[model samples]
Target: MPKQTNVRCPNCGIQFAAPVETVIDVSQNPNGKMLLLAGSLNAFQCPNCGSPVRVTTPFLFHDGSKELLMVYVPPELNLPKPEREKAIGDLMRELTAILPQGSFKSYMFQPREALTLQGMVDTILQADGVTPEMMQQQRDRLSVLESLLGAPEETRPSIIEQNDAKIDTQFMQTLSLLIQRMAAEGQTEVAQQLAIVQEDVLAFSSFGQTLMRDAQEQEAVMQEVAESIQALGAQPVRADFLSLAQRYAGDDQRLEALVGLIRPAFDYAFFQDLTAAIGKAPADEREKLETLRDRLLELTQAVDAQTQAVIADAAKLLQVFASAPDEQALDGLIRENVAVLDEAFLSVLLANLQQAESQGKSDLVAKLTDIYERVLGVLREQMPPVLRFVNELLGAPTPEEQQKMLDENAKAFGESLLTTIDAVSEAMSARGEDSIIERLAELRAAAEQALA
Candidate 1:
C-alpha cells in the first residue's frame, strides 16, 4: 500500500495528493518492485500541467527470497541527524509490523543503507544476476543510442558508421526494449523517434544488415518447410518426418525449421525409427543417416529447451499478475509488462483459465477472464486503427454482421480499408489459411462496393 502524500509540482506550482510508495517487498508487492526498477515508483504527473513529479522519502526494500533488506533516505531532505535516525526507525517498525511473526531475522534489525536511488536499483539488479559490468555496458549502449538519436539526420549515417562496432546484437535488443517501453508508457513521440533511430541503425550498421538478412532467410526457409509439411497431407507420420529430415539433411536452416514446425513428431518412436534406418543403410550411406539423426536430435533438444525457457518466463510474469492485490495494481502490472504479454504469456494464462474452470474455481475463472479481456483491450488499443477495424469485422459471426460493421465504418475507413483487406488477403493466402483467405476476399469485395 502507498501512503498518500501532498506533493507540489515544480513546473505548475500546484499541490496535489499522490500515492507514495514507501515499502517495496518483492514477495508481497511485486508492483512496487517493478515500478522501482522502472524508476517510476512514487512518480506522478501533475494533474494541472502534467509535469512529472517525484516524491523522495525514506523507504524500506525487502526481498525475503534473497534475504536482502535495505533502507534509503534522500539526503536532499536535509533532516537533522536525530530526525533521520527517527525516520529510519519508523520505516523499519512499519515493515516489521506488516511482516508475520517468527519471520523476522537478524538482517532486518541491521538493514543495509543505500545512499542513492541508482545505487539501490543497482543492488536489486545485481541480486537478480545482473553484474556491475553488464550494467555499465548497458549504460554505454544507451549513451551511444542517445548520441545517435540526437545527431542531425544528415550526420546520423556518419555517427552510425563510427559507432557501428558498439551497435551489436545486445545494443539492438536494448534499443528495441526501450522503444517498447516508451510505447507502453504512452510516449508516442519518443517511441517514434527511437523507431527512426532503429531504422537508421539497421541501415548503417554492418551487424544490423547481417541480422536483417538472416531474418529474411530464416523466414523464407520456414515458409518453404511449411509448404513441404503441408504437402505431407493432413496426417504426417514419423516416417514422413524422417523423410523430410533426410531431404533437408545438408541444410541446417531448413532442418531447424522443419524440426521447429513439427517438434512433437520427433518423439522417441521417430528417433528409434531413424536409428533403425541408420543401421540398415549401406555402409557408405550409414554415416550420413547417422549424422542426420544426430542433427535432428540436436535441433529437437534446442527447440524444446527454447520453448521451456519461454514458458518459464511467461509463467513467472503470470505469477506477478496473479499476485497483484487489486484491479488497479494489476492494471499497472499489465502496463509495465505489456511488451512481454505476447502469445506465450497468453497461452499460459489461457491454460490457467482452463485449469481453474475444470476445478470449478468460479472466482478465479472470473478474475482470469477479466484479466484476459483487459489485456486484449490494451493490445487492441495499441493496434493501428485500420487493423483494429479489420479485427472487429472478423469477429463478427455472420455475413450480415460483417456487412453491418463494414457499413458503419466504411466512411471512416474510406478507400484504405479495401487496400488493407487486399494486403491481409495476400498474407492469408501465403500462410495457406484457405478459409480465412476466402473470407478476406469476400470482405474485400464488400468493402470495395461500400466505398464505391
Candidate 2:
C-alpha cells in the first residue's frame, strides 16, 4: 500500500487526498486484484462534487504467478525522462525488496507502461486470460449486479430471476470480493446488503448449487479425514498416519488439503513416530513411507515457515512494546497493528506482560494495560463513551437522577451516536453477550425518544 496523498481531480478540478497504492505486488498482497476490480487502488472521488476521479499516478503492478509486470503513468503530467526513470527506479527497488530474491524476470525490468487507468486494469485482466468477450461479459455481470442491488425490494427478486443468465459462479465470486473490500473499508452497511444478495444468488442460481456442492465435498473430505483419525487410538503410530494417507492419496489434492487442515498435529512427536516407522518398515514399504514423510515435510514446512515469520514478527513487536518508555508511544504502536492484534499476537503480548509484572515492572504493566485498552478501543470505538453514559444513567440510583444526567448530556445524542450504539450492539452480539445487547437497545431507544 502506498501512502495516502493529494491528487487533482480532472472532473471537478479540485484537489483531494486519498490512499493511493503505487506498487501493487500480488505476491505480497493477494487482495491487490480486488482493489483493482473495485476501482479503489487508484480511485479517488472528487470532494467538492462526488464525481469519480482516477488518480493515474505512476504505479507499478505485478503478479508473479501470471508473469505480469505493468506500469501506469499519466500522459498529462508529461514527466521528463530523467524524472520518470527515477520514479520507476524507486518503484522497482520497493517491489524487489518485498518479493523473494531472483523471482524478478527480465520482462519485469521493462514493465509495459499504461496510457490510461482502464488500460492498466485491462492489462491486469488480460494477464488472467480475460479475453475481450470475457471482459464484456464481466461488465454485463457487473451491470446486472448493480441493477439487482439498486432495485426495490419487491422487484429485486424478479430482476434476479429475469437476468438469471447474468448470475453465475463468477458473479457470486465478484460479489464476495466486493463484500470483502467493503467490510475492510468499514462500509458495513453496503457489505451487509451485498452479503444478502450473494446468499440469494447462492440459493437461486444453478452454478451456485454446483459451487456449493463442490465446497461441501471439499469440506466433507477434510471432516472425514479428521473423523478417521479417531480409529487410530489416542496414541497412534506412524503406521496409523500412513494408513490414513493411503486411504486419501487416491486424490492428491484431497491428501494435500487434509494435510493442510491437520498441519498443527504434525509436531515433533508425530515426526518421531514416522521416523521410527520408517526404520521398522521393509525396503519397498520403507521407500513408500519415506516419500509420504517427504510429502508431509514439504507441505508442513511451507506453512510452518509462514507461521514462524508471523511469530517472529510478533516477538519483535513484543520487544518494541517492552522498550516503549511512555504509555502514549505504546498506544501508537498498538494502533498501527490493529489488524494483527490477533490471538497469536495477544498471547505473546500476554506472556511479555506477565514477565514484566513478575519482574516488578509496575510502570510497564500500566503501559500494557493502556495498550490493551486501545486494542479494545478499536472495537470499542464510539462504544465505551455511549455505553458508559448509559450505565451511569441506569445506576444513578433513581429515575429522576437518570433523567437529570440524560438532560445534562443531551448534546451527545445524535444519529452519529445512534449509529455507534447499533455498531456496539452488533459487536456485543458477535461476542455472544446478548443480555448487554438488550440493554444497549433500550438505552438507544430512550436516547432517541428524548432527542426527538
Candidate 3:
C-alpha cells in the first residue's frame, strides 16, 4: 500500500504527508465548559514550506489519554455553497471551445437554441459593468438552466451534447492545478524574508563601526584640548569638551570612549598645579600663582560630577571599557572601576543580608562570601595565581606584607581621591587634606598598577 498523505493546503489543493505537532485540548468536565490537554503531539511541520500544522486528535470513548486520529480541516478555508457554484460556472466557461452545440442541448434540456441563450447569460455575468445586484438576477435565471442540465436523459438530444461532460471534467482538473501552483509559491517566500533581515543587520553594523571611529577621534581631540588648557594655566570648562562630546552624546558607545579619554587629563591637571608651586618666586608672584592654582582646583572639583553627567547612561558607560585603549585610559579609570565595583559589592551584600533575615537562613551568607571570594579570584586570574595567594596572605599574619597591599590598593581610591582634592586646594592656595596629600605617591602608584 502507498503511504497516506497527511496534510494539504485547502487554498492551493496541494497534498503531502508530514510529521506535525498538535496541542490537544482536553476537557476534564463532561459539561464541555472546562478543558485540559491530555497530551500534545510534537515535531510536526509541512515538509515543503516548513509551515506549522496541527491535527485535532479526538478523545477516545473509554480511555481519556487514548485519542482517535482524525483529519483536520482549517475552518477559514471552507468555501460557501454559492461560491462553489460560481467556481464551477467559471470552470465551465474555460471549456466552452471543447463543448459542442449538441452537448449543450443535452445539458440545458431544451432546443439547441437554448445553448446559445445560456452562453449569452454567462457573457453578461462576466462583463465589467455587471454589479452584484445584476449578478443575483442572472443567477436566478441560471437556476433554471441548472435544473435543465440535471435531467441529462430528457435534455439529451435537443438541450445537451456528449462533449459537454468531457470538457467540464477537464476544467475541474485545471482548477486543481491552479491551487497547486499557489502552494508552490508559498515555499519560496521564507527565503525572501530572510534576505531582508540580513540586509538590515549589515546596514546597522556598518553604522555602528562608523560611529565608533568618530568617537576615538573625538577622544583624542579632548585629550589634546585638556593638555593645552592646563599648560596655559587655565581651567578647561564644560565648553572645552562639548564639541566632541556632543558628537557622541546621543551614541552610547562613543560617549563612553570620550569619558575614558578625558580622565587622564583631569589627573594630569592635578599633578601640574601641585608641581608648579615648588618653583622659586617672589612673595607677590608666588601668591598670584597660588591664587590662579586655587581657581583651577575649583574647576577640577566639578570634573567627576560633570563626567558622570556626560556618561549618565549605564548601557553607554559599559561601552567605554571596551573602547579604552589597551584597557588603560588613565590611572583614574582604575579608581573609577573600583568605586563602581565597591558600590555594587555593598549593594549585593546588603540585599543578601536582607534575604537571609527574611528566610531565617544563616547559610544565605554564603552568597556574600562567594562574591568576596570572586573579588580575590578575579585578581588571581588577572595576575598570577601565586601572587594573588601571596597578596591575600599578606593581609593577615605578616603585617609588613599586608601593609604593602593595603597601601597599594589604598593609594588609587583612598589616596587618589585625596590627591584630587589637594590638587584643587593647592592650585587655589586653599587648605589641603593632609592625610591624602602625604599618601599621594602610594595612591598614584596603586592607580597606575591597577590600570596597567
Candidate 4:
C-alpha cells in the first residue's frame, strides 16, 4: 500500500492545500530533489493565517529518514527560452497541417484575436534570422486556443480564478462580439443584446442625473440668501431667507446666487395667488361655480396642505423616514369643501335679490346692493394675483404636449440619429464588412416595403 501524508502551511501554523491545474518545480534541495505534486496527498490550509502546512510520508526504506510527502514547488517548471521557441515552431506546423486546405485563402479569416496574435508575432519577427519553424510553433499554440474558443462553454473550464472578474470579462467579450455581428448583419438578437448593455449603463447614469438636479436646486436656494444678505445688511434677516439658506447649506457653491432669486420669485408668486383668489369674478347666473374668490380666506392653509402632501409622497416613494399624516393637507381639503359651499351660497343670494326686486322692496334692494358692492371691492383687491395663478395652472402643457416638445427639437433628433449610427458602427467592427453591407441592404428593402 502507498504511504499517504498531509500538507500544512509552515508559517502561521495553518494548513493550505488544494489541487490546482498548474504544477510547480521543486528540485533545489541540498539532499536530493522534490516535485510539488498537486493531488498526491491531502493538503491542509490554516483557517486563521492561510499558510500551507507540510507533512512527511514514510518511504519504503530499511531504517532510513522518512521522505517528505508534500513538497513545496518553485516557479519556472516550463522549458527555457530556446527550447520553448523550438516547441512553438513545431506547434505552428502541426496546426497548419490540421487546418482545412485553403482555409487561409478562401475564408476571410475573421480572427477575433488577429490583432493581438499578429502583434506578438511581429515582436518575435523583429529578431534577426528567425526561421518559419519558430513562427509555426506559436501559430500552433494559438490555433489550439482558437479551437477552445469555438467549443461549447460548458465543455471548457473557465481559466480565470475569480468568479466576479471572470463574469465581467466574459460579458464584455460577449458584448463586443455581439456588437460586431450586429454591425455586419443587423441581426435582431444582436440589437437586443445591445439594448441590455445600454440598460445597465443607464441605471448607473440615473444616479449622476439625480445628483445634478439636486445640485441645481440647492444653487437656486443659495443665490436668494446671498442677495437678501446684501440688501438688508444681515441685521434681523428675514425668516423666509434664513430658512431657504439653511435648507440649501449642503448644496453646491454655485447655488448661492440662484437661491437669492428663487425666494423672491416664490414670494411674488404667493402674493399673486392671494390676489387672484380675492378678485375672481362671480360665476354665471345658471351655472354655479367655485370661483377663486371663495378660496381667499383659507388660501394659505390650502397651500400648506399641498406642500405636506407633496413631501409625504416623495418620502414614501424614496423609502426614507415615514411621513405621518399632515394636518396641512387636511386643512387645504377643508378649504376646498368650503369653496364648494360658497358657490351654493352665492346662488341663494342671487335668488333672494331677484325676489326682493320683483316685490318692489326698495329698502331690501338697497341693502343687497351694498353687500354686492362690498364683495366686488374685495374681489378687486385680490383679482390680479388670483387670475395670474389660474392662468398659470390652466396654461401649463399636458403630458402629450411635453412629449411633443421633446420630439420636435431638430438638433436633438439629429443627435439621436447620430447616436444610433455610432452604435451600429461599434457593432459592425465585430462582424465582417460583407455581412454589414448585406444587412444594410436588407434593412433598406424593408424600409421601402413599409413605405410602399
For each candidate in turn, the TM-score is 0.81, 0.49, 0.18, 0.15
Looking at model 3, residue 252 earns an lDDT score of 40
TM-score of 4: 0.15
Global CA lDDT of candidate 2, please? 0.70
TM-score for model 3? Answer: 0.18
Top model by lDDT, which number?
1
Model 2: runs farther than 4 Å from truth?
A: 1-37, 42-116, 123-131, 152-169, 227-258, 264-452
lDDT of 4 by residue, 236-311 (tens): 3344443443344344342334332333333544444534433453545212112222332134345556556655
> Per-residue lDDT for 108-132 in model 2, tens only?
8788887787888887788778898
Worst 10 residues of 2 by lDDT: 328-337
lDDT of 1: 0.84
Those runs of model 4 whose alpha carbons end farther than 4 Å from true positions after fitting are 1-162, 166-187, 197-246, 251-452
lDDT of each: 0.84, 0.70, 0.38, 0.35
What is the lDDT for 322 in model 1?
78
Q: Higher-lDDT candidate among 2 and 4?
A: 2
Q: How close is each model in CA RMSD to the real structure? A: 4.2, 10.4, 30.2, 36.9
lDDT of 4 at 345: 40
Error of 3 at 220 (Å): 14
Better of 1 and 2 by lDDT: 1
Between the candidate structures 1 and 4, which one is better when assessed by lDDT?
A: 1
How close to the true structure is residue 11 of candidate 2, measured as C-alpha lDDT?
Answer: 64
